[model samples]
Every structure is written in structure tokens, then in C-alpha cells.
Target: METISIRAPSTPSSATKARRSARTRLPAAIALLPTALVVLVVYIGCMLWTVRLSFTSSTLLPKLDWFGLTQYMRLFANDRFVTSAENIVIFGVLFISGCLIIGFLMAVFIDQNVRGEGLFRTVFLYPYSMSFVVTGVAWQWFLNPGLGLQKLVRDMGFESFTFDWLVNQRMAIYTIVIAGLWHGSGLTMAIMLAGLRGVDKDLWKAAKVDGIPTWRVYTSVVLPLLRPMVVTATVLLATGVVKLYDLVVAMTLGGPGIATEVPAKFVMDHLFERNNIGLGTAAATIMLITVVIVLAPWVYARYVRPQGRHA
Candidate 1:
């Protein structure tokens, strides 16, 4: 006896699924297109335009004349620009380091399950919620000699007290650093606290079993685990350092004879106040280059290198 084989009919479920997926994705694609276009047109386009302007002799009005590296050369030679660059370097180093140290300590303290943890966390993180302008203004008043700390101290019979960094040329940049620490440490603390909270309890127990000192455990084991958080906080702080305009404006206005001038303020002065667009754009380009150079290694290590290794 011969037996015939019977085959089941193919269903259109795959085709139906594909059609459903396409229908669902179309709206999302449509929604994203506008944002994509805006980024391309607004951000990338403006960046390119600014860079192009940097290479021109544009002043007062954008002339678009080929000026080559004249603007950069001029920018480097400018005393105010040089001073601004130096001030920024000082501020960045101190601010980043101070924020990390203070933030880590705060996070560690809070991580001990201390009483009033909520209140302490709120107090620490409160400064971060305030705008840089507000922080700057507050710090400016607090550090003022005649009307602030110095006066208050004098009122307490300490007539020789002098806390005049805001108006003191040599120490003005440090005041900015202090204000930055106040404004930024809170954010860094929050980041560090999150990282600390994410650490496995088993590791702590193992460290305890191994008789590792608390400081050693933190310095050796926990710090290594918190590297990502440190990097994140550094990046945020570095961005703030780069765009440090509002704070300086509110506090010092690049005062004490250009002692606290920063690159962002330099750019703004040239672009708007001084009517030197070429110089401004050149400074802006340098800033952009600096940021790119700083971030490239991390970006490659974090994103590109992993893909290459996987491949």
C-alpha cells in the first residue's frame, strides 16, 4: 500500500507581523525625523558655520574673507585671552579635584546608614539644584571683604581679618574654584552615592572577612568599582568648566583687572562686546577642539574599542 504525504498550508503570520511592525515604527520614525533634522540643521550646521567664520577676517560684520590662521595667531597673542586660558586651567584642576574629593567623602559618610540621612543628602545636594548664577552671587557676597565675611569677622573683634579674594587680583580665580566646588560637589556626591549603593554587599562582607581596613577597602576595592561614576562626574564638571560664563559674570565679571577671565567669557566679549567675531569663533573652535581631544580617548575605549574587540 502506498501512503501519500500531506503538507500543512503556510500561514501569513510572518508577513502580517512585518506589516504590523512597519505600521508601528512609521509614527516613531516620523516623530524622530523632525528632531534629527533640527540637530543636523541647527547644531551641526551652526558648528560648521562658526568654524568657517573662525578662518575668516570677520569683525563687526561677517566678511567671509579668507584670513587663514590669523585669528588663532591673534587669539594666542592677546594678553586677556592668555590670562583667561590660565584662569580656566586653574579653575578646572581645582574644581574637578575638590568636587571629587568632597563628594566621595560625603557619599561615604552617608553610606554608613547614618541617622538623618535624608536631611544630610538633601543639604548636600541642595546647591546643585541652584543655578550657577545663584551660587556665584551668593559666594561673591560671602567672600566680599568690606561687606561680607571680613566685616562680620571684624564685628566679632577680629579687625585684621581679610577675606577679599573676590576683588583680589591674584586670588580671584581661587574664589571661582571655591564657588564651583560648592555648586558642583553636590552633583558629584549624588553620582558617587548612587555608585556606592550599587556596590554588591557580598564584596563588603568579603572585605570584612579578609580584615581589610575600611579606608583600604574604599581606596583599593571600592574606588576601582566607582571609576565609571568618577568619569561621569568629571565629564559633567569639565563641561561646566568649559562653559563657565554665567558664574563669572554674576560674581566677578572677569574682574580684578582680567584676573578671573575665562575662555567662555573671552569668547562672549570678543563676539558681542568687542565686535570681533573672527577672534571669538577662533576661541570657540579651540574650546571645541579641546573638548573633542579630551573626550576622544574615553569615547573610543567606552564605545568603539569594545565593538572592535567583539568583532
Candidate 2:
């Protein structure tokens, strides 16, 4: 029997493909190096620094001395901080609810093929385009008792008209809610409108053929389909609720005596005004914790659970 020499097939093609992939990826990796460094240094570094500082008794500056949870103890005990936590909860609830309701309604209205659709969308989104500082200032002027709506109404011989929520200690936080709604509702509307446009036209036709009312169709079919958009809008609105510093600073200054105070403003006051870095970081950490607690469940439901199902 002639022994035939058997040779292994060359692996050059596989090796070449691997080499090509590396070459293709190298430039992209090089391009992303600066962003990775910035994120590691600026964001992660700052977060770690804040957490470390929260355990200290630093005053006027960041001191590396470990002081346990004294700052957190003080944070919870402080009336202003407690009030800020309460105010944020109330404001967050009202703001999110108002935005969802008003935004959904506006989106539905706009989806009706009304004339001047572009103009209406622009007008709705105009507030979001304006900076918070500008929105706050304009709203401040508009809500001012002596100079704004109340004054104008009073000048019209309705001396009994009163709209002094901006000055009332108990009601000042609600004014923040109103301004927040005005600034954020447009964004939610835009998100909802995009979701609406993506819905299959066949679904609308099916609903009509079944003699389902428009509102019923929205409530039954379209609303469920818009879950992802609602989640997106809620997250965006919730983020705005948490970092609610600039609007409150410009509009209310956390007053009528800390009635409208929020966690972000509380952190800023301790860090800068009160010269208490430990307390500031502690407040920030608490805010971070609160946000995580609120968002973790939603994140798990939306992303992690779906991934687990596939796995």
C-alpha cells in the first residue's frame, strides 16, 4: 500500500481574518482612549472622591480624615435637609405626573394632522430650548405678584385676584412644579409623538374597523405600545427632578425659607455657602442612593430581565 502524505489544511485564512479585525479595531480604540481616560478620571474619580469625603468631618475643604457617618447623622437631623428631601419627593411626584398627562395629551392632539403642526411642535418645544436660568427668570416675572400675572389681572379691575403661590411658604414648592412642567412637558410630548409615529398604521385601521373610539383605542392598544417611550420620558423627567438646582435657585432660591429647597441645592449650599464639604458630599451621596433605589427596579425590569429571558 502506498502511503499517501496527508497535510493539515493551512490556517492562514483564519489568522488573516483575526489580524484584519485587530487592525480595524485599533484606530477606533485609539480614538476612544481620551474619552475613556476622561470618564475614568473626571466622572468615576469624582464620584469616588465624593464618597470618600462623605465619611469625613471636613469643613471649609475636603479633609481626608475618616470620621465615620457623623456627617450623615447630621444630614438627617438637620431640618433644612429633611425639608429638602420632603420637597423633592413632592415636587418629583407632581412634576412627573403632570408632564406625563399633559405631554401625552399634547402628543395625541398633534397626531391628529392638525394644520400648523410644525409651528405647534416648535411652540411646545420652545421652553425646552430655553436655558433653565432663562425659563426661571421668565416664569419668575410671569408669576410675580406685584409685576406679573397677578398685577395684570388686578389692573384689569379684579382686585380680588390673587396668585401669590410663589411667595407662600406652603405653596412655593408647587410653583417650582409648575415651572418644571412648563419646561419639561414639551420634551415628553416630543418623545411620545415619536413613539406615536412609529406605531403601525394598520393598528389604527384595525381599531377603526372594529368601531373602537379613538380615545379607547389609545387607552387600550396605543398606550401599551408606548411603554418604552413612557419609560424614557419618566427617566428623563426624573433626572430633571433630581438635579433641580438652577430652576429653584433662579425662581425661588429655595425659599420662602427653604420650602422649595431640593437635594441638589442643599448639596450646593453646604459645599459653598455653609463651608461644609463633608455634609455636602453626604447629601450628594444620599441623593445618589435615592436615585439608585428608585431607578434600579425600572432598569432591571426594562433591560436586565429581558436579557435574562434570552439567556
What does each candidate score in C-alpha RMSD? 8.5, 7.9
Clashing pairs in 1: none
Relative to the true structure, candidate 1 reaches a TM of 0.89
Each model's TM-score, in the order given?
0.89, 0.90
Model 2 Cα lDDT, one tens digit per residue, 117-196: 99999999889998888889888999999999999999999999999999999999998999999999999999999999
- Candidate 1 has its poorest 10 consecutive residues by lDDT at 1-10
Mark the regions of model 2 whose C-alpha exceeds 4 Å error after superposition.
1-27
> Global lDDT of each model?
0.91, 0.91
Candidate 1, 3-22: lDDT as tens digits: 11111122337988767766
